[model samples]
Target: MIRTILLLAASAVAAIFSGCRSAESTASIPAVRPFDAERYLGTWYEIARLPHSFERDMTKVTAVYTARKDGGIDVLNAGWRNGEYRTARGRARFRGDSTVGELEVSFFGPFYGQYRIIALAPDYSSAIVTSSTCDYLWILARESTLPLETFRQYKEQAAKLGFNVAALEYPNGRPE
Candidate 1:
């Protein structure tokens, strides 16, 4: 009876702690319905994102997408690094049809990572992209600047999907 009691107590404790970490999760993350890939194709300015090593100190970043002849997407990521313009070219392919909003993108050759369109404006003015893992998140806008109200709305959307918006890094290194 004592062993059973201890096991039950341990399980309860584990569940409590896990719940404290986050309420957002992959199972709860949502993607836009019927995402229009054609309108989504073009230049997007990075307003904020979760920082990663590959893009360290990158400012004035932009992601330009163009459809390739092979029915895949060609990605061009450009930024100002150490006062010099730097760019990385990659490719993206949809997991299903363009409307599904599921895709994979890669900066390095062959290897790819998940890229899901979680939230998008009807006019294609702004978008929020994240991985299925919900660990990687990006807030992109058609212009370098975003309206205050719109930014807040996007933040709420990302938070609802389980992203830690408080940790988002503005590429210019200043809190807005």
Candidate 2:
């Protein structure tokens, strides 16, 4: 009984903190409209990202997205950590209008995180993605490598959105 109570207490505390964090992070961030989900679906190579605990020491990261019959998206994120390949599966759904680029993705049951596509190339060849918070950011491309100019342009966009662009880690080698 004591253990169960303790667990409940911990969960309550965590929920409170997460609510606060999400409120602050999601504020003022706008998701691109007239977004084409079909164009965005596919494999994306991670060129750079801000360091985070979940992806710590990870390299060669990649994310795969596919449409689910339920009008949601299946997310497959893979990477190499300490020379070992690891993967995480998640699900995502648009927070509001399907045409918007804002989504809520959940790897853990019932706990969703914000996924906002802040920038994308005209041809959908590259993109800049981030969470509700400034703590998470990613530069992704359809190919394993992105052109230097394209990479720089994405970084600048993230910086303008309040992310720490200087802290991005290029696990696949920095774009030349």
Candidate 3:
């Protein structure tokens, strides 16, 4: 009888712990406040990001944002692969269904992914963006580089949002 009781107790403990992990996953992801999309438009260098198949073996990545007449936005992503420069043009539209900091971006035809500006510097010098699933992430800067402290803060914020910070890939270390 005692053996059966202990087994039941152990199972209960495991189930409780599993629920706690799900609570962490369900925690809402936060976005930056007072985001100015106009001021945010321009060339931004990609400092780091979570590794993805599309960006494999890429370096010196950069993005340029431009406004469209329809109130949507244009995205030009460029990088160097094997000493050759490659680029991808896409479209982004603010998630009118939700907050201003949330946008939907698409590289392929008509399909979109959630993009939230989880962090941004007051002067618009730096920004960190990520997907709602915490699968895709990027650290960008108006200049070629940002302070080491800022980098750490971005990682910390991403961690709080339930992301895997260890997967971050620095394309060009401390870009010059």
Winning model by TM-score: 2
User: Candidate 2: misplaced stretches above 4 Å?
Assistant: 1-15, 22-26
For TM-score, candidate 1 versus 2, the one ahead is 2
Q: What TM-score, over all chains together, does every model reach?
A: 0.81, 0.86, 0.79
Candidate that scores best on lDDT: 2
lDDT of 3 at 22: 20
lDDT of each structure?
0.72, 0.76, 0.71
Off-target runs (Cα >4 Å) in candidate 3 are 1-27, 97-99, 174-176
lDDT of 1 by residue, 24-121 (tens): 33545656778877788999988888766666778888888899888788888888878898777778888777787777776664556567788888
Instruction: Give the worst 10-residue stretch by lDDT in candidate 2.
Output: 1-10
Question: What does candidate 3 score on TM?
Answer: 0.79
Residue lDDT tens for model 2, 1-176: 00111222343357577865422364587878789998999999889987756677788788888999999998888888888988877888899999998887776667676678888888989888776557667888999899998888788777777777888888788785
For residue 147, model 3's alpha carbon misses the true position, in angstroms, by 0.7
**What's the number of clashes in each of the models?**
0, 0, 0
Query: In candidate 1, which residue ranges exceed 4 Å CA deviation?
Result: 1-27, 172-176
Ordering by lDDT: 2, 1, 3
